[model samples]
Target chain A: MFEIKDLKASIEEKDILNGLSLTIKPGEIHAIMGPNGSGKSTLAKVISGHPDFEDPEGDIKLDGKDILDLEPDERANEGVFLAFQYPVDIPGVNNSEFLRMAYNAKQKYQNQPEIDPFDFESLIKEKLTVLNMKEAFLSRPVNHGFSGGEKKRNEILQMLMLDPRVVILDETDSGLDIDSLKQVSDAINHFKSENKMILIITHYQRLLNHIVPDTVHIMADGKITKSGDKSLALTLEDQGYDAFKDNQS
Target chain B: MLSKTTNPKTMELETLQKQARDAFNTLGFPTKRHENWLYWTPDNEQKALERKFYEPSDSIKENDVILIKNGSLRSKPNNNNLTVSNDTHDYQNENLSFNLDSSSLSYLNTSECSEVITIRCRGIINEPLQIRLESDHTKDNSTVNTKVNLIVEEHSSITATFYHQQLGGAFNLTNTSFELVCKDNANVNISHVFKDNKSKAFFHSIIHMHEKSNCNHISYVTNSLLTRHDTNVTFYKEEASLNLKGINLLTGEEQFYNHLTINHKSKNCFCKQHFKTILDDKSISEFSGLVYVAKGSHEVDSQQMNQILLFSDSARALSRPQLKIDADDVQCAHGSTIGQLNPEEIHYIKSRGLTESEAKALLTYGFAEEIIEEIQDSHLKEALAQDIKETVRKIKS
Candidate 1:
């Protein structure tokens, strides 16, 4: 249900994402593997409508509607969720309070009845079965002093709460221990359905072991150099990106 | 109109002015020239030169009195266990002194006064005492100086909220001298809110603590106009504790100045100071705090912090936190932070589906809550929260 064609995005005046293009339909999970500083996060930020990153030339459409002009919040309202690799530590704002406000804002934008605290608490508790996080995490400030794994799990919890149509995980597996990686993967897989699209951005293939993607895309410099089945990831893992350096997109 | 009454009226104004002018001239505006007032400076261009004493307007019915103005409690009419001694200039009360600057004055009033307002509860109060002091006139020059003495008896606890409401656009001076004696095992919390208008006003306050007394003082001063405020606190008894917090919320083309001093004179006394400031639209704020640890005051633990949020190019904050530790064995540290809003916090809040303005509003509210939560008064907290929201919105707009 999402499509990106020849995407070109820049931060300030520097070009980062050059002529990049990719697509994911309903029920599809795609892995975007790229090395450090390879414009992996920029793609996610551009799609999420981060104000500092602007798409100068490209088209991103959700269900056939262009979303380049939408503000970051508007993009989030349109069901685009980007799980940041390094979660921010928001001090003084209670976790539950933040969740409620966010959930209500999305609900109000979609013309749905807002969930009260009671319902929201129950909803989060029900979903916590996957992440197995403690109740105290909901009371403390969001992500402040949280373990790396806990931060990743918290992102998954937010994704489950928002239940976005297109979820972009920007290296969510990084910094997470093996156990946290499994929990995060399981949570994402649990939320995966025929009506949802998932784009996984990572530097390694370890997460693919738990949540297998339908397709894999290799990114170099600023463009998606290759796209194939899950075996493509295996091939890249074996030969490294050097094999595709000469035959770039 | 220059009748005998009118002439004496002028003479009274002149007499009051001379006393204050002399005191200030002698004190000589604690300046950067002086180490104590180094952080803040009043706008010399806009001075409250003329003083007009309005006849006490009994217009505010007794029922309208909220028992506390800003963070100071009312003690005259009903309660008995809470003894409020008068330390005003007219009374021959024991004088309390501090190393820093102080100005005291007295005025005549016919309003009813209470000797004791008892607060015997042992639990924390969710409704903080709110003292809203409105000027008697909208445009008349004025001076209001009074000493409010709060005494918490042994095995008791209470929280007082004070809101200094400057409703009129007139030049005014308000001096609130508070003395709180918390007996053994008693707890006292006080919150002070200084509301600013288009007038020039100067607020000076000094609070003293007794033996084994625990007192928390919080003040929020939002300046949209020119104002000068000073708060001095001293703890004299062993095992006593104090928490002093000040926040300066400012905007517009005004100069706001604040000088605070806390003195710890006894052994094992503890104190903490935190000041947060938000400035925009060419507004300037100067905040200076000094914590003095007397000799033999062993095991004294204290920390001070000043954080400023600059929202515009011309906004400024001059923060100086100084400490004088005569005791070799003491824990005293201070820090200052001057920066804009955390961009990541703003992005995180915005990504949660709130617009930029909405996200900023939440961040500013959260920043103020760090000190507001210590107030222990729900009504006062809510009122202060409302004021914070309004201030943030005003800055955003």
Candidate 2:
């Protein structure tokens, strides 16, 4: 289980996540929907332990252990994965090589044996089929010259490869087209397991239609003002965040 | 009677050598005052003119490999279409005379070299020629001068690989000059691998191309204390093309300099030059390339690019790409870039699970792989790739 209690994070002396509290148990997919500047993405970043954020208050626990003090890679090794909204392009690093390194790092952290190149190749080739990616994509540099939809698919591709315990998808559906959206959603759905927890932070309710969440929370002004079942997302789609914003005040 | 029977070509070469010697005496060694040599200046302790010459004491008798030790050819392969001669005999081609006047180092090489090693290719040569230039391990501070002449006749194709290695740790000064001529419809490829010891090396090469000839020149430099390479190419006829590529990997306190000049003196010629360097520790690298398109040389395409990656705070790079176009219809472009590895890129790689050192090694290897991928010889390509990976490992550790 992943838990956050009164998490107040700031960057450059400006508070982005103000007294936010949430709990996600295994086998539950929760979606956080809010308007612009409502701190949804900041919450995801704080969960992933981004170094840009200053001293954060409260506790972020993974299986009852405080993880806020861990480095980004350390958090990742502890089964925390964040699919960045903007994937960085690293020229000259082959995608397959990068993926192998990442996978082996996690394996070593878990005290597991490293995967041989041939075995890793077979594993990645299987995952590539799930995302409908061509074999040539493995040879190209990481995220270099990739289209918007391709970059998103690559993020999900990484998610599948790592298979972390807590998966945070921050706006993974913003720039994706309908076809790519369907493909990415299918990949995410395929990765869902009974022991894994998913946090989807989005501005619109469109992505929730593809991968229906167990619960929906409406955030405004750096705080979650409303929480309910999946039908709340439908109501928000009909009434808009303005109705909730007025109610919060 | 012997004077009457003297070869006119040999007499002309003697006169040219005398002229070159006079010019060398007047110009002397280069200094910071010379515009073309502003970045490199010899130390006062190292005098180019007052050094002793040593004869070679080691030789390799391999069949496919020609070994040149201490400025003398010790072995050659027997082939029907190729000829190797140590003595200067009637090699005064017009192409050799066109591109040797740009630098005083070439003149010095011409003046001081005792014997010239000439390799002439006539018909199609099936095998690549491997030439190894090695210094004797006598533990003495001496200077060696070597001159090589390569001639490719019409309708022939050949590949040559030159490996330079030093066997001792003395203050060795090496001055090497190469004259490459490709006749009409000939195809030639030359690869130079410089893996010298802690010695100072100065190399000058002049290339001339005839009608419809194609030439490719590739050089790799690594592990030299102080090195400078001066290359000049001229298109003497129409429809010729040239491709020049180089890579330099420097670490520790090494210093490397490359100066390239490409002259398009004819119509419908093409040229491309790409050079990349990786500098680590407190090393420094410099590149200056110039492309000149003379008048009436229309329909010419040229491109020059130089890129450097600095891995340390003290590492430095200076790059200058200049183009001079006098022709009306031509396409020319030049670009140069010097930068360190991107932090965001490194973070991204690290976030994916690699350690900081592993991430850096991967990025550095990727930078040099661009030039290594273009090598046509699989054996050479594999060897270079292994060398680059080892270099990255050494830097990280």
Each prediction's TM-score versus the true structure: 0.85, 0.91
Task: Report the number of clashing residue pairs per model.
Answer: 15, 0
Could you give candidate 2's per-residue lDDT for residues B138-247 as a string of tens digits? 44566677788889999989888889876554366777888899999999988999985666788888888899999888999999887889888899899898989988
Model 1, runs deviating above 4 Å: B1-75, B84-95, B98-132, B137-139, B153-155, B182-184, B196-198
List per-prediction Cα lDDT, in the order shown. 0.70, 0.82
TM-score of chain B of each: 0.76, 0.92
- What's candidate 2's DockQ score? 0.53
What's model 2's TM-score?
Answer: 0.91
lDDT string for model 1 (B1-397, tens) is 0112222222333343344455554554334576544544433412332233333322223332344332234332223333332223322222323112343221111111221122233444434444454443354444443335455666667777656665555455443444455666668887776666655556655666667778888877776476666677777777878888776788877777777777777878888888888888888888777888888888889898988888898887787888888987899998988988787777777776878888888788777778877766777778777888888987763
Residue A172 in candidate 2, Cα distance off native in Å: 2.0
Task: Return the top candidate by TM-score.
Answer: 2
Specify the CAPRI tier of model 1.
Answer: medium
Worst 10 residues of 1 chain B by lDDT: B107-116
iRMS of each prediction:
1.4, 2.0
Give the Å error, residue A103, model 2. Answer: 2.1
Model 1 residue B172 lDDT? 50
